[model samples]
Target: MSRRPFLTLPNSHFFLASRAAAVVTTLAAALVAVSVSAPALAQNTPASSAAAVTGGAATYDTAGASAVQPDDTNNFDARQKDLDRRSTDNNYRYAVAEHDCYSKFFVNHCLDSARNEMREKRAVIRKEQLALDDEQRAARAQKRDEQAALQRAQDAADAPQRAANDARNAQAYQDKQRQHALDQAQRTAEAPQRAANEQAYQQKQRQHALDQAQQGIGASQAAANQKAYDQKQANFQQQLDAARQQGAQKAQQRVENQQHFEQKQATAAQHKADVEARQKQAAEKAREKQQQQLQEQQQQQQQIEQQKQQGK
Candidate 1:
């Protein structure tokens, strides 16, 4: 007879807890990666990756007599700039949270929670931008294909006209060469005066360019000064906001501390009352036992006296 192997159930609660911890750790690491490396990835994501992201049929917008294809390069460049701006904005928000988290009471928990939130926000924006890029690329590709087909048709249709144009262009080129020779002879005769005029014109252009450059430099310096002032103002505002936040946090912490102290005092008072009540009950029970013992002794004494009277 073949023996059957017995199977036992695994510890489900332990298994679940371990799995949950692993998932949380994984997600936390992913959040950190997204926070730190996301901008670099956005900047360097290759065409193949984009193709993978946009793997579907491209749609085109055609209008009267020509297919208007989207300018993929310009659109993507704009999209990249937008993505960079958003990433910078998101990073700023993260920086604020990170600052708070580090300074907060529960540092690790606050930091982890902030990172997780940042990851979610960044992931959503990146995914949306990538999807848009994919769609645009596909549309551009379809437009190019359409344009190629139109060009081929145009080429076929213009074949006869092209031959006639070639003959006319040959005659026109011969006429132009003769005119060019005559013009060259005239130009040689006038070369000295033309050279003098050209040199004066060039010198005037150089002076004008120098004046414009000086103006540009002055404007740039003014703009830089304005930008520096704006930056200083922004920094001051940020510091002021941070100071206010710190004050508010300190006040909140004080309130929480006060509440905690009051709760502990209340609990200690209740525990003391319970202890006193227990002691009083114990004393009452002891007194009742003593009284019952004394009553029993008195009854025995009375019974002995009655027996003595009977004997007498």
Candidate 2:
């Protein structure tokens, strides 16, 4: 009888075969799982957010073309906040999906799908964010334009007043220029008087020097000059005192006249008011008496009609 030889493979080869079978099984499972869940994950905020991104595309450009209306501004913050939350949530879900892919056989495809979904959500959020920003900017610009228009209208309305003020200022400036011209002419006219005064001052100084030289000639002449100077000073002081007294008297007289005028005005106004009050009272009494008499006449006529009807 012939003995049959049993052919055996190496342990490593069997191990490799088993590992490859397990890898194939895992790959199929991962593909099925990803196929089922990729849509769900992509659709996390997809339906409504996608609609918003599409609809708001028009609004984003509308602000540049026409103007943003009040309706477009409604729920702006709420919509933006929703987008922001979705963006954050989308990134977190991608992280989770990517982490799950590491344990699976095909990590690259899983990561690629997660990244694509995250980008799609980000694009949606970016579009909505851009739309909100455009809307806010348009509203601010419109308000600024309206305010500027109102300011221009106000300036237009005040144009006449401003022109009148400018004209008055010009007249005042002309008056000031005329006054300055007059002052200059007066200064020119005073030049000769100033020269004469300077000449007189020079003559007085020469006379004073001559007097001093004469005083040096005799002590008696010096004493006479001193007496004359004392007399002049006394006379000047008396004149100044008298002038001050006169000024005080004039000021007191003016004050008395003003007080007297005020009293007279007050008295006259009070008398006029009293006369008016009396006239008003008399007129009011006469009107009341006339009204009472008219009412009594009407009542008597009504009674007479009643009596006639009773007789009939």
- The lDDT of model 1 is 0.59
lDDT scores for all predictions? 0.59, 0.59
Total clashing pairs in model 2:
0
Tens-place lDDT per residue, model 2, 42-142, is 23431212222334453222112233356655666555555454544555566567656554545566667667776656554555554565455446657
Q: Give the residue spans of candidate 2 off by over 4 A.
A: 1-78, 105-108, 154-161, 182-312
* TM-score of candidate 2 versus the correct structure, residues matched by position: 0.38
- Work out the TM-score per prediction: 0.31, 0.38
Candidate 1 error regions (>4 Å): 1-41, 46-80, 160-312
For 1-312, candidate 1 gives per-residue lDDT tens digits of 132343343457786466456655655665676667756656654222243233342222111112113564456666665565566556656666766553344556666777767766665455545555555656675776688579668867986896686567556656755765775588688889967976886686568557666776677765665577578668867986997698688657756865675686577569758966885786687568557645654664465457558646
- The collision pairs in model 2 are none
